[model samples]
Each structure stands twice: as structure tokens, then as C-alpha cells.
Target: MASDSLLLTADFPRTVRGYAPSAVDEFLRSLGSRLDALQNQLDQQAARCEKLTADLSAQAKELAGYRLKEAALAGALVATEQRRAEVEQEAAGLVERAREEAEGLLAHARAEAEQIVGEARVRADQLVAEARQARQAEEARILDLCAEFDAAVETMRRTLEAHLALLPEPGSTLAELSLGGLAVADAPDSLAQAA
Candidate 1:
């Protein structure tokens, strides 16, 4: 029982030492934040898919209901076969009316679909544009940072080379040196200028 209580000791954290744990904790926090963002985006996308699926299911149900009503009418009418022949005889006239109705429905559906798709396409384009702009900004920042780093590194190399020139080598001067042997000298300000 006492050993079980010892397991619950909160003072263990206060006893820990060094920057190692703190650095690890910072890295974990950063990783957690990124993962949380990804999770949220995934959740949003899942919700969108779920809603779209539900809407499509409802539309299918409505269309099925219409089909059932049409079938019921044809079944209840005993003279359906005779009427079907008459309807077929006037099919040419009805065909035009049906064509008009179908065209109207198609136009409406197309307009609605276009409205939804256009809005989505616009939103997607905006998001893509924003992402591209963000990428460009990040790339510009990285390029600037890289240029600064390169300049700093070149400066450090030049300083080191200058210091190295002040030290005496174990061997001879530049003109006295063979092809493979190194000779000590200060670095030129610019290789292009030296050339």
C-alpha cells in the first residue's frame, strides 16, 4: 500500500535535472500543435463528405419516390395498355412537350450545379492562390535567410583564412611550392577581382 502511494509521488518532476527534458517538451508541443491543425482539417473534410453523402441519399430517395408514384398510377389503371398505345400514337406531340420539360429541368439542374461548382471552384482557386502566395513569401524569406547565411559563412571563412595566413607553415613560400604542396597566403577580397 505504501509502495502504491509512492508511485503517486508528484515531487518526481521537481527532482528532474537539465535542459534535455525541457527541449524535448518544447519539440513535443510544436509537434502537437501541427498535428492538431491537421486533425482539425481532416475533421472538417470528413464533415463535408458526410453532408454531401446525406444530401445525395436524400435526392436519391426523392427520385425513387417519384418513380414509385408513376409506377403506382400505371398499375392502378386497368386500361393502361390501351392508353399506352394511344399515348404512343400521340408520342410525336408528347415527345416535344417532354423534350421541353426535360430541357427545362436539365437547365435548372445545370444552373444549380454550376452555381455550386462555381462557388466551390472560386473558393478552391482562392485557397490555391493564397497558398501559392504564402509559398512565395516563405521562399523569399528562405532565400533572404540563405543569402544572409552565405554571406556570414563567407565572412567567417575569409577571417579564418586571414588568420591562417598569419601562421607560419612547416614549408616554403607560394613561388617555391610544388603542385601538390600548400602555400600560405591571405584570401583575395574577390575571386572575380583577383581573376
Candidate 2:
């Protein structure tokens, strides 16, 4: 692991066992060149490693952001589901209340209809009773008129019979003069029947 500066500047002692200075200098120069090439290769590798580390860090940050977005979307989905359930419950309650109200209204209407029918029936009965009373009164009045008519006819027949008794016998001149076209026997009976 000799440095390039030390290799270039190293000196050998002059002795019987020492190597030639020219040959040693040549070998040291070759070793220094090879070391410099290896160092350059190592520096290039280090630069590539640093760039790859930065790229990895950026990708990790992007992955973390995507995970956060996914979590937020899941939370939103859960909240939406809860809200939809609440709305469905509210709609069901509203429908139930409407049905109850409609049933109540129907019951009320039925009661009113029954009451009205009952009143109508009572009024009809009253009207029928009044009609029957009026018919009975008219019948009684007609019967009284018939009785008065029969009594007047009986009084007129008696008056005619008394007048016929005052008349002469059938063949008399006075009877013939008084009853112009009737026979005496038929006169009283015919006049009474006509009356």
C-alpha cells in the first residue's frame, strides 16, 4: 500500500548487494501508475453509489405519499357509508309517519261518514212520520164531508115528501096542472131519488 509520492521519491543505498537504481526507478513508476488507475475506478464507483442512494430516497418518499392518500380515501368512504345509512333511517321514519297520518285521516273520515248516515236515517224517519200524520188528517176530513153530504140529501128528501102529501090525487086536474109531464104515483118517489 505504498503511496504514489513515496514510491516516486524513494532512494536505494549504494552497496554490493543493492539493485540498479535505474531498474528500481522504472518498477516504482509502473506500480504508481497502476495504483492511480485503481483509485480512479474506485472514485467512479463511489459516485454511482451516491446517485443510486438519492434515487432510492426519492422513491421511498413517493411511496409514503401514496399510502397517505390511500388512508384518506378509505376514511372518506367510511364516512359516506355512515351518512347513507342515516339518510335511509330518516326516510324510513318519514314514510312510517306518513302512513300513520294517512290511517288516522281515513279513520276520521269513516267516523264522519257514519255520523252523517245516522243523521240522515233519523231525518228520514221523522219525514215518514209527518207524511203519515198528514195522510190521516186528510182522510178524516174527507169522511166528515161525505157525512155532511148524506145528511143534506136526507133533509131534501123529507122536504119533498111533505110537499107531495099536500098535492091532489093522481087523476085530479090540479095534480096534472102542478106536475106538467110526470104521473102522480111516480112523482114523489122520482123526486126523492133524484135528490
- Judged by lDDT, which candidate is best? 2
lDDT string for model 1 (15-47, tens) is 345446556566666666666677778899999
Sequence-dependent TM-score of model 1: 0.33
Cα miss at 77, model 2 (Å)?
6.6
* Best model per TM-score: 2
Q: Estimate each model's TM-score.
A: 0.33, 0.35
* Candidate 1 residue-wise lDDT at 140: 100
Report the lDDT tens digits of candidate 2 across residue range 127-157: 9999999999999999999999999999999
Give me the runs in candidate 1 sitting further than 4 Å from their true place.
1-94, 166-195
TM-score (C-alpha, index-matched) for candidate 2: 0.35
